[model samples]
Every structure is written in C-alpha cells, then in structure tokens.
Target: MIETANYTAYFDKARLAGRKLNLAPAVINAILEDVALAAIANTDRILAENQKDLDRMNPSDPKYDRLKLTAERIQAIANDIMDVARLDSPLGKVLMEDTRPNGLNLKKVRVPLGVVGVIYEARPNVTFDVFALCFKTGNVAILKGGSDADYSNRAIISVIHEVLLKHNIDVNAATLLPAEREATEALLNAREYVDVLIPRGSQGLINFVRNNSKVPVIETGAGIVHIFFDEFADLDKGIGIIFNSKTRRVSVCNALDCLLIHKSRLGDLEKITSRLLDKDVELFVDEESFKVIENHYPVHLLHKAEPEHFGTEFLAMKMAIKTVTNLEEALDHIAQYSSKHSEAIISENANNIERFLNEVDAAAVYANASTAFTDGAQFGLGAEIGISTQKLHARGPMGLEELTSYKWIVNGNGQTRDH
Candidate 1:
C-alpha cells in the first residue's frame, strides 16, 4: 500500500517539474494525443480487465449498475481524450497585461493549481477524464476512485502511466491510491499533501469528503435539476425538452429530477403526464397537479412537497411534479428548491427566457433547451473533471481552464518601495 506521504512527495516533484518546463499549449496537446492513442491501442486489454471486475461484483450491489463498461463506453472515453487534446492549453497564457504610469509592467498569467486530489465513484470513464484534464492543465492529480471500479480504474491508469513514461514524463504526474477505503480516509486528512479535494458521486460521498477533508474542498452538488414550463411555452418544445431531459441517460447528475409547470398550463398537463407515464416515469405530484391527473392516471400524491423532496437528487426515472401560479412563483420555487446545478425554462417569450437565464443561480441555466445539455462534451469542453456547483473557484462544467489558477507576473528594474 502506498502511503499518503509517498503520494505527496511525487506530487511535489511533479509541481517542481511543471514550474520549470512551462509547457506550451501545442506540446501539451501532443502529450494528450499520445495518451489518447495509448488508450485506444490498449482498448481490448482495458475492456477485458473491466469485465473481470464486473463478474466479481455482486449484481445486487447498488453500485453494480454504475461499474459496468461496454464497448461504446470505452470508445466514448477514447473520444473524450482526443477532444481534450484539441482544447486550448490552460497554462502560461496571459490573462491580463498592462503597464503602470511608473513603467512597471504587470501580467496575470494562468498557472496550474499544483496538486489536486480527486475522489470519485463507480465510473471508469472518469479515470480517463481526470487524467487528461489534469495533465493538460499541468497539475499533478491523485485519483481515489471507488472500490467497485478499482480494477477498471487501475487498468486505465496503467495505460496512462505507460504513455507518460514513453514520453519521458514522470508517471507520478497522475497517481492512483491503493484500493483500500482506509487509504482514502487518510488521504482526505492529508492537507499537507493535497492542495484541493474534488469529490464526484453521491451526495453522501460529497458530504463525507467535505466533513472529513482537511484540504480545501470544492463542493460539487448532487444535481436536483428542474424544468419550468411557463404558460406561454410551446407544448411541442416543452414535451421534447422534458422527455429528453428525464429519459436520455437518467443516471447522470445533470438529468432532470423535477418538473414545474405554470398552473394555467394544467389543462395541457394531462398530455405531458401521459407521455411521461408511457415511458415508465414515476410522478410525485403536488396537490393541484394530482387533482388534474388523478382522474386519468395513478400517481404518488402528496399534499405538500417536503424540503427533502425539493433537494432530492433522484438519479433515475423518478421525478417530482409541481404547478406554479406564475413565472415569478416558478423562479422562487427554483431558487428555493434547486441544487444550484442546472435549471431550464421552456418558453417562447424572450423576456421570460432572459429573466430565467439571468436570475437562476446555477452552474448551467437553459432557455428552450433540455437541462441535459449541461455536460462537458455538449458545452465543447472536450472532457470535464466534474460539473461544479460551487461558486468560488470553478462553476459549471469543469474543463482544463477550470483546473488552473492564475498568478501575477511583474517586470521591474530594481525599484525600492516608497522612497
């Protein structure tokens, strides 16, 4: 088992190398291209290892569903690496440059965040995404993935390590924690080793990391996304967005969990609800929505939405249904209930769309589009480490640029402060 101190020493060395190399965007892209090719070439080995992991996993285990990797999944991971290779390098670029009246020049330049600690769960694809993003941005990353996907994650990490070694780069730039739960706990408390901790998975996991981690934490919320269909919303567009948002890959964090409709639109709610029911979606409807749909369909009726329901991240075919009096009410409901992850307004009215986009306090806000578009690939970010709901460091889909921080560079001729 690798100790936390050993991991910290590796990262410290990587950071020193990063500061010295000052890698250009083109060079970074080339390295990424090599990594992508390595992954693709080793696809067969990767999939075989992943299948072995799946076979050993218990089917009844809650995480079993998230641990399986298919051919399409592997291809998607390879494609994501290629896409990341094409993105602009996030290091050494000048963000701002100016000269003071006294001829002292100042520049704000992009720099790596040094060493980042990523704790994630149950998706082998994340192994690739994290490696590419951190490597491209010149940050050393320590990945502590879930035990369920340990085999797959290790296989992918091995391929990446090979690529780094082939390029004469230190393999320690990306380190994987030993497959042990206690190691993760120890790593979380190692603030001296880790600069920041980014956890991606269940709300429980994020909460655990936040509470126990001594390192700076960037909280990524469990998404409780919402879709508000205003009175003036085009029925066709509304149905399309809602269906796509809820049904197109329901297992993701950005999937819609609640649907809010204007009360005036209740007359047409039956049609929408019918379509959703046909797709096997369970509706947890509010009192008013229940009355309109109860006569035609069976639903889980509740008099009032509990605070827990409002903040619940139902990452499945279940959704909470509510009817608002007006756009204002809908906005208020969203502000109060949303997880600040993603929100959408399906309406033809420009004023309403503008208001929703401007006022919604979320990582991604959409108008006349499905909340599902709040993804890294959809937003042209190549690959994302995770979707950040936190406001301080990074928000929205976290790409290469989000993985970096900025520093000020000054050029002056031997001048003393305040003579």
Candidate 2:
C-alpha cells in the first residue's frame, strides 16, 4: 500500500551511505550482533506481520511456504546473520601485489561492490540475508520486496533500522523500497546509484530484470534442475537422494524439477520414485518412464510429459521424468533444458561421475547427492544473495567473497610512465 513518489531519493541516499561506510570489523560485527538479537527479540511481532501477508495468499500456492515465516524460521535467519557477523571480513584483503621496476608499488585489494539493489519476490528472509551479507561487505542494500510479503518485509526492515539507529548508522544504509511495481521500475533504471542488481524469484522475474534493467544485472536464475540416474548408479543412493532433492523443500530453487533415468535403469524408475509417492508428487513422465511408472505411482498424480514439461521449474511437488539412452543422451537433454542452476548425476562409476561433473554446464554439479544441497549456508558462506547462473561476475551461491570486487592501489613517489 505504500508508494514512494521519488524512489531516486532512496537510491541517492544508499549510494552516499555506501561511499561513507568504512567501519572497523569489530564495529560491523557488533552492529550485526545487535541486529540478530533484535530479530529474535522481535520474533512475535515479525510473525504477526508475516501472518498478515500469509493470510492473503492461498496456502496451496508454492510461494506460500516461502512467504510464511515461523518462530523457528526466524531463529534460523538470525543464526545465519550471526554466522555472517563471525566470518572474516573480505574487505581490504590484498588479492594481488607487485613491485614495479619504476619504484612503484601496486596492490589489488578487495572492496565492496557499493550499492547492491536486490529485487525479489515472496521470500521475506531475503531481507535479512541481503542486509547481513551486504552490511558485512560494507555494501549498501536497497531491497524491493514483492507485494506479497510487503508487511513481513517491512516488519523485518524496521527491526534492522532500530538497530542501525541505536548505532547511529544511517538507516538509509539498508533501505526497503515500496512494494509497488513503480519502485521496481525506478530501481531498474538507477544505474548511477546501484552497482549491481540481483533478482531472486521466478524465471520470468529474472528474465524481466535481465532484459530490461539499465543497472548491471547478476542473474540468480530459476532452477530447471535435473538429476540423471546413471546405469551404474547405486539404487539405494539414487532412491534416497532423489527423494530428498524433490521433497525436502519443494519451494526452494535447488529442489529437483526433472529426473533423467538411463534406459537400462528404467526398470528401477518405479523404485527410485517410490518415496515421492508419500509426498503425492505429480510426475510428468516421458513414454518410457510413464510405461514403467504407469500403475506404480499414484494415477492421480501421474501424467504423460509434453514438450513444455521438460524445461519447467515446477516450484511445487511436481516433477518431470525423462528416459535417456546413455550418458551422452542424458547430458544432451540437460544441456537443452537446464537453466544452468543445478545439475546432478547419481553413479558409482568414477568415470561417469567425472564426466558428468566436468561436462555439466551449471552453477552446481552434484554426484550421488541431492541438488537440495545447493545453498549458501550449506556451502558455509553464511547466507547468499542468490545463486548466480551467469558467467561474468559470479556463478553459484554468492557469498561474502562473491559480494566484493577488487580495486588497484598504487604507491608511487613521482614515478611517471615515459615512452
């Protein structure tokens, strides 16, 4: 319901605050500790606000789980904030140094990326994550959360602002823009103020941001994730891994969306997906997989696959199953349909695993494990802005180090270049 007439004011403030943020590591940690404590202390209030947002959405919607926050989820978010506070600050670390023959010393040191503007949907936890990760790196945060979670996002931002005000830090250092579409448009065009824009949401949202934004965009791509059940795959491992990958948290980006089984392993398909039955997972299966799973899986939840089913990121308890003749066919299928988010191969054969890991073009490649492990906290980076699928700046879970860029520092005493 809140709208800003001049969103540029927010961007300007963030840019200025970013340029001025040079606190000592201890100060930053102290502030972050206060924020974490504040979040936990305000648990009830955050929940109450979160409930308002949840009430507006259908519970059956895939984003409902992502939008709704509980006491335990809030506690986990606070823990991640503390984890970020405890990690070593990457700023000022000399990445490279050289002494030139011209009596000049040169060094490249890590620095913040300045103003990081994140446009995301539904997930209110991203507010805390963007703040924690950006603040840790001395980068300013300007978040534009979706309208669906506006109330929850606003509540979380207020807690952060309370802590910032207590520390006499500029509240604008972490700004949450209005949850209106206009705010998103303003943010997309603010290239002068925002160093980078990271979009975390559906493929449609990511694509929209990438195609339209004037600001340099870091694509946190949608996961049209897949896992291949190789002929040599251990059936025991394949069963458990696929189950967890699809059912552990279906709303997450890393949750499995497609399963590729070797033609020889088609017999084992029913057994592999046996656990998904418990979750009532809907399967869009190819002819081979459908024939194998026809009467095995719940008839109500099974359907023959269409061309559209192959590349879809079903952020629900729905998945697609394809039958590949060999490793090459599996690889080709994934290469065609994958969003390059996460890809996996379940196999005991060392050669097959190596080939899959090396040849699979994705942000993360797994061997005999669930793609669900593709996360920042699981990777030990505390929290992440998003999993970048692009090749330029960052790829995979963007952690503290990924939030930084290097600047060259040169020390010279009247040493000038002469031709």
Candidate 3:
C-alpha cells in the first residue's frame, strides 16, 4: 500500500494544479520549452545516471536497449518536447454542439483527465514524453518507472520537478516513485486519486496492471506486430519495407515481429533473408519458409521457427517468418497472433490493399509501408504518452487529445427530466 502521508499530498496537489493548468496552456508551453533545455543541459548527468543502471544489466537484454539514454536520444527527446509545446491546446475544446428537440442547447466539451498514473518498464525517455504530453494537455502525471531505470528516471524526474518549481507550478504536477513492486501495486490501485493508469512495457507488466489495477488502465506495449508481402506486392519495395520495419529499431513496440510472404514469392524470400543477414538479423523461419531458403540464404543466424516463436514479440534483431499460400491465410495468421499494435501489408493490387486496410483490426494498419510510422510524433500528434492497443476511451498513438474526456454541457431555460 502507498504511504498516504506523501502520496496523498502529491495527488491532491497535482489535482489542484491540473485544474489550474486548464487556464494556463501558455505557461505549460513555456514549461515544456524550459524542460527541453533542462534535458540538454543535463544530458551528461542523465547519461551518467543511465550508465549506472546499464552497468547492472547485460547488453544482450532487450531492456538494456530500452533503458539506454545517450546524448543523441536526449537531443531527440528535447526536440520532441518542443514539438509538443508547439501543439494547440487540447482541453476545453467543444467537440460538438446542437439544439435538442426541447430547445435545449447542448455541447460536448473536452476536459482534462486530472491525474494520470504511468507505470512503465525501462525506457527513461518515456518519462520526458509522458510529462510533456500530459502537461501540455493539462493532466498531472505520476510516473512509476521500472527498477532497472531507477537512477535514470530519478535524474529525469528531478529535472522535471525542478523545471516545474522554477515556473511556480506545483511539483506534484509530476511525481516519481521508487521503482518497487509494492509501490506499483499501490499506484495501480490508486483509483481514488488517479483518473487513469497507463502501463508501457513487457506483456507481463501490462497483464499485471490490467489484472490488478482498480484504476482504469491504458495498455501501451507488448507488440507482436506483423507485415505481409502479398503475391501482388512489389518485391523490391516490399523488401525495403520489411528491412526498415524489422531492422530499423527492433526494441520498439511498432517494430515488426513476424514476416508473412506469399508462397509464390519464395524467391523473394531468399533476397529478403540475404538482406536481413547483412544487418545481422536472426530469422526464425517456419517449416515452409525454412525450406524455401534453408541452404541458399547462407546465414548462421537463421533457425526454424517453433510454435512459441510464431507467437512471440522479438524486441531484438530476431523475427519469425511464415509463408502463406493465399491472402486469406496471411490475414488469418495475423489475426491469430497479432497483439493488434501495428500490422502492415505490401501489395500493388488495389483490392488486396483495400481489404487488408479495412479487414485488419489493429491500432495501425499500413499499406506498402513499414509499421515504424506508428508513433505519436510521426502521426503529427506531438509527443505520445503511448500507443493504446485496447479500444476504449483512447486507442492508437495516445496524444494530448487522448488524455482528455468529454462531458455533455447543457444550456437550458427550463429543463425537466420527466419532460
């Protein structure tokens, strides 16, 4: 359980700050700009602290990649924050307005979600992203980062609180807890204070939050994303898409996990395998896909895919490959194994592209493109809190708008419920 002594005070202060922030989006923007500069000024300090965490883990661990924050990444983080500062306000905007039959003028207006609790594993960059996004949209954030990134998170959160204090904003607008399971559980169950909880990390973490949290949760990670190269796909173009999606940065949620190729394109599979080999990508190939390029590919990293491999999200330089006989088989395989984060199809045929786009159920479905574009920044939504896999109040790349809910506002002269 949380020690209300400190936790309650923080939430109360954050709630009040959230309400007050509704009238001060400009101040919020300035805070973001200042915070961005803070990161740049503290890059050496941030990376030094991050190195402490990294030294405790093996480079082979995927979490290591997620936890590492370098100078370039800090710069990128700062740039994205500035991008968020440039975005228009998301709160208090009228979604819709009209007059009802009883001559009552009604409108739906967006409102801040109050306090947002974010429980995430590794990735200290998320600390900056979540703060900038939540602050921009007027939602206070309580960040509980993973134990591995404890030092890194502390350094980052300290900077955030420092910036907030400088701007005379309540430090409670952003809070960081010691990374412990007990503390996470308390945060998960903080329904009385937190309006919403978002978990971004491994499947285990996401599942635990969903099963345990009394507060409403928005899931952000665990991507068993896939891409299909249909028979009609432009093979040269398809190869580039696959290479970029799978090899660009495998530690991300939007990175490709599986590759589905039409049986007719068996030769193209060899080319794709050979190209992946150059990037040192390990291939977990299905029986059919293995047979197609077993001896010809000449890559030691290649292995036959197991049942578990097909269902796995390889957040590394590893991926599963399946050869589908037809489009339906490819679609069925994706539907069966997808975490619904991002799925893509590379096809020149209009019908195949249209059907793939329409029939696939995912946060992002792409045509002749990589799944890498499934990001809040890439979608022109500034910095994203996370990509929601579940469909509820928010889905896909969660931007400032996702941190808001709407209420029905009624203008009535004389309204009666019984009327």
Best lDDT goes to which candidate? 2
Ranking 2 against 3 by TM-score, winner: 2
| Alpha-carbon RMSD, each predicted model | 2.7, 1.8, 1.7
lDDT of each: 0.83, 0.93, 0.88
Residue pairs with backbone atoms closer than 3 Å in model 3 (clashes): none
Each prediction's TM-score against the native?
A: 0.92, 0.98, 0.96
Per-residue lDDT over 1-419 for candidate 2, one digit per residue giving the tens place of the 0 to 100 score: 32333676888788888876899999999999999999999999999999999999999999999998999999999999999999999999999999999989999999999999999999999999999999999999999999999999999999999999999999999999989898998888887779999999998899999998989999999999999999999999999999999999999999999999999988888787788898989999999889888988878899999999999989999999999989999999999999999999999999999999999999999998889989999999999999999999899999999999999999999997779
Candidate number with the higher lDDT (2 or 3): 2
Backbone atom clashes (below 3 Å) for every candidate: 0, 0, 0
The candidates, ranked best first by TM-score, are 2, 3, 1
lDDT (C-alpha) at residue 116 in model 3 = 94
Candidate 3 residue runs with Cα over 4 Å from true position:
1-6, 101-103, 413-419
Worst 10 residues of 2 by lDDT: 1-10
